[model samples]
Target chain A: MAKVATRVSYGEALVKYGVPNENVVVLDADLSKSTKTDTFKKVCPERFINMGIAEADMMCVAAGLATCGKIAFASTFAMFAAGRAFEQIRNSIGYPGLNVKIGATHAGISVGEDGASHQCLEDIALMRTIPGMVIINPADDREAQLAVKAAIEHQGPVYMRFGRLAVDDLYDDDYKFELGKGVMLRDGKDATIVATGLLVQEALKAAKILEDEGISARVINIHTIKPLDEEIITAAAKETGAIVTAEEHYIMGGLGSAVAEVVCKNAPCPVKIIGTEEFGQSGKPAELFEAYGLTAENIVKNVKEAIKLKK
Target chain B: MDAKRITELSIIANKVRKDALTGVYSAAAGHPGGSLSIADLLTYLYFEEMNIDPKNPTMEDRDRLVLSKGHTAPALYGVLAERGFFDPAEMKNLRKFGSFLQGHPVLGKIPGVDMSTGSLGQGVCVAGGMALAAKLDNKSYRVYSILGDGELEEGQVWEQAMFAPHYKLDNMTIFVDNNGLQIDGDITKVMNPTPIDKKFEAFGWHVIVIDAHNYNEIESAINEAKATKGKPTAVIMKSVKGKNVSFMENNPAWHGSAPNEEQYNQAISELDEIIKGLEAQL
Candidate 1:
């Protein structure tokens, strides 16, 4: 299948699922073309609002619309949406538990050419701190589309992270998406690779590499980072004895920390985290990922390292 | 409009001031200056202006008020109590743990509080969103938001100033309590947001200047706002930092400080005198 950016899938999903609902109002802060919210604007101009570079105002405006019974979708770059307008999201949306969906695009270092300032490595961490905030980071196009449907239906403050970089299709028509549930792709008894967002594809590739090397690796796609599927994570720790976590975000508070938190509490196991420890510089998306050690090779290395610690 | 009605509102406004001070004193911490400044406006809104039923605050199609200046929750809680949204006795639990009356206004926690606000600038933008929602549904329920002069320092406030007009939010009206004081000393000394009227006009709003404490002027400005078309209205009411309470008036020290036993008694007596005078007029 053709490679598609999750942001594009998000735009298409907004039209397919969001446009049909009259109460779904979409707001963008002058990044409609990049965020793909323009697709929703093109079809449903009446419900669309171009908020013009003010992410803070855009967030609170969505909260206000939600009060009047509208499912307001506010889209912007993750750096601006989750980083710049965090307090607005917390006080206006999270405090009241309003029905406002933040479609944060350009999350992680995959946002090529936009250096450290635009790349939002801390979005998951920032959004994670807010109470009752549902965080969704889909792995691919199909999951991104399905995630949008889930966000609109959940009826509370939801932060959906999407990427600017196009990723290959990971799931097909047979795939089912569930909120707060992790999908087990390839099961193994040696070690598990728990990954989210674009890294899930890398995890499956790493699992294949591990099998070639006579080492079994389980692959699990953890799309929902918050309200994490603790059962699956704890099961992976107990069944596999060790686990490796991969994501395009920081090592401190993304999927790695979330998985570790559950593992330490539920099932004691050695866990290795695969992500950037420092800020990202402007470069090609593939080059940045390679430079940051966010690759299939690195996941394989971490899986072996975690297995060693377990032994 | 009428003498008897004005006397009645003045008496109610005095009661709101007493109740607000009572809540602040009981809590031993809360904003009293801006709360007192906007007490008359809140009284006017809850009593004479807004299409709200304290009994049915969640009624669809009812007008909504977003207290964008959320530090003034004591005033909002006071007016809600006066309007019968809850028992007046509940004001004593202002910021105590497990109280519905949080430090800042929270929507679901407090009845008749249309939007949750505390961190400045967010509430005004939310109010604009509420106005847009009303226009989208063709609902006649108007949206009202009160902003502090100091709050204009927030860049987000200006963003909403631009948004309200760009979307043609005529159903919305904003009351700027130009009390000239923030947590810091003077707003101009801190950050000059002077020419407040010109700023709103430049942003495509029908600007109206009124004495915030005057019932007739508050009523007239709202009337003018309702009559205007294709744009929202900004009623910049020049007000004292603290009004009614003699010692608190114009004193930035009273901005967020809770009055002591002696001061609270004096404040209550001052409001009692005003209420007695208004009743004598009746």
Candidate 2:
């Protein structure tokens, strides 16, 4: 499959669902083009609202619309949606459990040259703190398209995390998007490489390299991190005996931490988290991935280290 | 609208103020100054202006009210109780554990509260959204919101000032409780949200200035807003911080602090005299 950013598919999928549903409305905080909400705007201009540069206002507006039975999708950069307007989301949307879908793009250090300020690595952590908040971090363009559709159907508040850079297209058209279930891409017996977002492609490549060395590595894609499918994750940990969690986020409280929280309680297995330990810097997407040890090489190295601990 | 109705509302507002003080005194922690300041307007809205039923609080097509300056929930609770949303006796449960009377106006917990608001400058934007929905659904329900003078210092309020007018939310009316004091001190010296009328006018709102405590002015301003067309209205009320109570009026120290036993008795005695005089007028 061709490579495309999840943000691009977000715009495309929104139009797919929004054009047919009269209740579906879109609100943007002045980043329509960047967040890809402009795609829905073109097809359903009447349902789309531009709230200027006010992210908090946009979120509250969405909450208000949701109270009236409108399925409102509010979009902005992850930094603005999850950080700048965090309290609005918590008090206005989360406190009420309104049906406001927060479409967050440009998350993680991979936002590239925009540097540390633009990158949003802690969005998932902040969103997870809210009770009953559904979080979906699609790994590829196809997954993103299905996620947008699922978010439209799902009730209550959901935060859909997307990124700026294009990565591998992992899922096909026939792949179904479940809310909290993880998709095991490859079956293995030695160790499990649980990954999310753009790093899922790197984990696949790492699994292949481990296969050459006769170490069978299982690769699992965690699309939904909040209502995390703990049963599947625990089964993988128990079967493989070793687990390595990778994500395009801060290691402290993201997918790595989420998986570790599940495994430690359920399986009590050896798990190594591969993510950003420090803040990101200015660099090309590829350069930043390599510099931050988020490449296939690093995933392969972490897999071997995890397997050794199991032995 | 008439002098007789104005006197009747004045009596109800005094009870509202007394209950507000009672709730704050019971909690031993609350914002009494702002509560008392907005009591008259709250009484007018709940008793005279807005189309709402306390028994059927979630009725569609009913007018909505968002208290943007949510720390003054004591005033809202008092009005809601007086309007039969809940028993007035429940006002004494304010800030108690497991009590529906939370420090702020929580949406589901309180029957008449339309939207949950505590963070300054957010409720107006939400009210703007509610007005927008009324347009989309072809409903005729109007939306009202009240903002503190100091709450204008929050940037989100201006963001709403821009949005409501841009959308031509004619069914929306915002009341700025310009009591001129915050928790810090005088709003002019504390943060300076002055030129309130001109700022709202600049934001494309139909601006109206009024004395918040005046029943005639409050009624006329709301009628003027309902009559105006093609734009939102901002009725900026020039008000006293702690309006009625002799010791609390214009005092910023009472902005968020609860009254002591003696202080509560004195405030209640002063408010009871106003109620007596208004009743004698009837």
Candidate 3:
């Protein structure tokens, strides 16, 4: 078995980039330690603002800072940043097309212990619906650091989703990351497994398992969900007749739905979406992943079904 | 300030009240009560106090005025039109489809609107951000935001109140239109935000309480705000829900309702009398 590389937490990645970017200001809604921006706060107190559970005010204030040419990153749990401050994000940041990076940590069922209230399963739908919003779900800590740097340079609203649990790194230290591009990790012909966030690692694992069984499975990392890499996805769909989408989000209006929208519009193909069909229950992260059908085993099963349907 | 000039501003305020009423009435929708109540404050800021260019609305160094209680956009539009930001003829397009004048203030659509604000409690925070930006840029531009007393019930307002003081945004001045009525009923019944002055003072702001309709006090309070430094100022302007118009005064029904023909005629007469008194003083 191939050894998996060590992964970095999104919080650690933010601190590494935040130290070099003086114009970068971080705002936390009393979840500094939880969201991992506390590392940045400790290093640069002047650039950090702990807004103490006021997500709406933080969103607006970030918009204000962005208007003044400062790259402001507002951090909170995905539920609060995406759900609580929905209107504030829509009007203050999205309406003005401000360069504000929203780091929504504890996304999806990975926020296991905190339960459904903290797990933001619907953030992608809410954020993607807003005009000019860039949605990014980094696969690992290395990708998250690159995503943060890229988002800071991007001149519009961007929502970077990160998980609470640690995952194996999918990319090398020197791997290049772009804003609106997808990366193909493996080549195959029978079926394609397109995934994002923590699911990227799962999809890669599933592809390896499928390769052993004499079935060729292609693995694609769709990090940037919005402004989706339709060309790559379309080409992959045409090359590999069937596609399976895996994500740590709800089946509706997330990575799966985004891919479906692109493929349905551009290239119609047999597709299967693997994600949570109901609200997540309280359990260990690994347990929840299995319970919610968000495992590589499930991806392998869904891909086989999709490949059968393709024939 | 000279008495004659103050009276001239009073006359302007009266005309603004008429314009606000007529705009709301013609549109068949708007917050006429609060708009009328805030006319003097808006008139005092735009015509007499603020250093803004009607031609260059987006000038970097121009003083910014945000209507936090943006439902009272008719009041702002009336004052901005009187200041020649746009033609007064456009005033008739209030709340109409495809008009620059929306139901609420939208920036860039209308000149002199610093921020698009329809959602209450957010405009003040945005203004605070603008004030902070001005300080950072080392510009002499001041930011003035007028909020509805009822809108103060929003928790975000207090969050911004705390933030403004922390930043020492003395370049910003916040006015609370204390008309005491919201859409449902009295502000106290809806959500009491009493002791508004102490609330600002507690938030580390320089508090000033005055009659919002009185032009002299309004002008003087704004002048006092300019002199004070190192902290933001909150002027709690005591105003009636609907000022001058007899049928609408303190009536919550008039909060968003336009006046009918007879009611509009009587309201115009009252405003005319107030304007004539100010003209005589001028």
- Report, in order, each candidate's fnat: 0.92, 0.67, 0.33
DockQ of each: 0.93, 0.75, 0.48
Off by over 4 Å in 1: none
lDDT tens readout by residue for model 2, A174-263: 898899999999999999999999989999999999899898999999999989999889999899999999999888888988999999
- Candidate 1, residue B100: Cα displacement in angstroms equals 0.8
Ranking by DockQ: 1, 2, 3
Candidate 1 pairs with clashing backbones: none
Point to the candidate with the largest DockQ: 1
Single-chain TM-score of chain A, each candidate: 0.99, 0.98, 0.95
- Using all chains and alpha carbons, the TM-scores for the candidates as numbered come to 0.99, 0.98, 0.92
TM-score of chain A of 2: 0.98
Classify candidate 3 by CAPRI docking class. Answer: acceptable
Clashes of each: 0, 0, 0
Of 2 and 3, the candidate ahead on DockQ is: 2
- What does DockQ come to for candidate 2? 0.75
TM-score of the B chain in model 2?
Answer: 0.99
Which model is ahead, 2 or 3, in terms of TM-score? 2
- Cα lDDT tens digits, model 2, B1-282, are 788999999899889998888999999999999999899999999898889999899998799999999999999999999999999999899999999999998888898989899999889989988998888888899999999999999999989999999999999999999988899998899889898999999999999999999999998999999999999999999888777899899989999999999999999999998889889999
Could you list the chain B TM-scores for each candidate? 0.99, 0.99, 0.97
